[model samples]
Target: MTKVLLAGESWMTHSIHVKGFDSFTTSAYHEGGTEMIAAMRAAGLDVTYQPAHIAADHFPLSAEALAAYDVVILSDIGANTLLMPDRTFARSEPTPNRLRLIADFVKGGGGLLMVGGYLTFQGIEGKAAYAGTPVDDVLPVALMTRDDRSERPEGVVPAIVNGAHPVMAGLTEWPTFLGYNRSMLREDATLLAEVDGDPFIAVRTVGSGRSAIFASDCGPHWGPPAFLAWPGYGPLWANLCNWLAG
Candidate 1:
């Protein structure tokens, strides 16, 4: 089985409510990758998911730790989470730069896949801010320096441009997506699908490893329920993981 470590795709929300002259605060935690993880696991891949808060402290800190998994996936998580762990942010202690570690891991023949969201690739208001990081160099696309989201409420359907690629195997028709992160395809990368004149799915070989980008969320609000229910969903993810693991 392909060993995969997926970081992010979970968030916590805090809200205040007012009724009459009283106010109350509420907090909730949510995961957006439940279906995606199940789909990958059903395909026989061993997936270890680390939500945003957990990943801030628990994401791999060394090449040896990263080597335990064939692929590392970053989705809906900002660079700061991995960059400033507790030791570095709170204790004023020097810590391993996880972004650089991931970059080296890819160069050392590991696989990397970045799925887009509000906090993935140069996200909303540029808060995701992955443009100039070490991990940016390892991605198949060049991220913008500012906010890169393309809102397509009218529904944008991705078109297959590289049907022959292994990642597209058994995937013929694709459902519409609500939005996606816009990125420039790197010169050395292969584009598998495209939407709104941007690279929707792109892949590249980095040193002895491989890297790919899925320019949208694995679930809503960028990925709609229709897409999650699409018959090709499971096969698409499986094929991509297998191709990357190889």
Candidate 2:
């Protein structure tokens, strides 16, 4: 079994209001890490999900902890969560930095996958700025801006750029993305998919490890409806996971 470590914020409260109504209410939201883990496991991979509800100043906690997984996944979380000012940004002693540790892990042969969201790769309003961090150097593509986010309607579609790659093997065409954060590709990056010429999916190899960036939300509300409802969703993510682990 391929050991995979999945990390992200699991709980969220969103403010929503009825259409054309002024009244608003708060709704709960959870990250898609668990869903992806389940899908991967169903496809025959060993997945261990480690969700961080609060930000940590130091990364990985321990080198021993970092060595336990073959792949790590970051979805829908900001940089501050992994690189807080101190071990306790609110109040605590400074300790090991998890972001730096993650970079080292990748450099030492651990695969990484970064999924898009309101808080990933210079997310909405520049909240999840990851441009200058150690994590950036390992990613396949460069972020567009620390503050810009683009949205596509329900019917908007994504085009495949590298149809022959293993990641795109079984997936010839994907359904429309309800929306995605916009990003640009590095000249050396391998473009896998695009939307209106902008890179939607990209992959690259760093050291003995592999990295992939999916510049779109993989959960409800932000991801394409077809992604969750489509029959191929499981295989699509599974293949990506396998590629990353390799």
Candidate 3:
């Protein structure tokens, strides 16, 4: 089985509840990668999901630790989470740069995939902030310095530019996505699919490894219920994971 380590796609929200007389705060947690994870596992891939907070402290900081998986996925997570662990952030202790470790892992023959979301690639208000990081350097597309999300509440259709690519295998039709990140395709990268003429799915070979980017969320918001219900949904993710593991 292809071993995959998926990080991010989870978040906590705190809201203030005000009733004319008083106000109280409430907090809730949510995850967005449930469907995607199930799909990969159903396809026989060994998947380990690390929510944003958990990943912030536990994501591999060494190449040897990362080597345990064939593919590493970053989805809906910002750079700061991985860049600053408890030791580094609270104790002011030096730690290995996790972003560089991921980049090096890919170059050493591991696969890397980044799934888009509100906190993925130069996300909302540019809070994701992955523009010039080492992770950005190995991606098949170039991220924008500012907020890159192109909100399409009206929805947009994705066009498969390279349907023949293995990553798109068994995928014929696609459901509309609410929105996606807009990115520039690299010269050597393969544009497998696109939305609004911008890269939606792209891949590239980096040294002895491979990397791919899905400019839209894998589950909600961008990937609406209609998309998650699409028959090809499972196969699409399965294909991407398998192709990357290759």
lDDT of each: 0.94, 0.76, 0.93
Model 1 quality (TM-score): 0.98
Better of 2 and 3 by lDDT: 3
* TM agreement with the true structure for every prediction: 0.98, 0.87, 0.98
Model 2, residue 83: C-alpha shift (Å): 1.2
Residue runs of model 3 more than 4 Å from their true location after superposition: none
List residue ranges in candidate 1 displaced over 4 A: none
Clashes per model (N, Cα, C within 3 A): 0, 5, 0
Estimate candidate 2's RMSD in Å.
Answer: 3.3
Candidate 1 least-lDDT 10 residues: 236-245
Model 2 worst lDDT run, 10 consecutive residues: 50-59
Taking every candidate in turn, the Cα RMSD to the unseen true structure, in Å, is 0.8, 3.3, 0.8
Give residue 82's lDDT in candidate 2 (0 to 100). Answer: 81
Model 3 per-residue lDDT at 150: 95
Which number leads on lDDT?
Answer: 1
Residues 1-246, model 3: lDDT tens digits: 999999999988999999999999999999989999998898899999999999999999899999999999999999999999999999999999999999999999999999999898899999998999999999999999999999999988899899888988888768899999998999999999998789999999999999999999998888999999999988887888888888
- Score candidate 3 by lDDT: 0.93
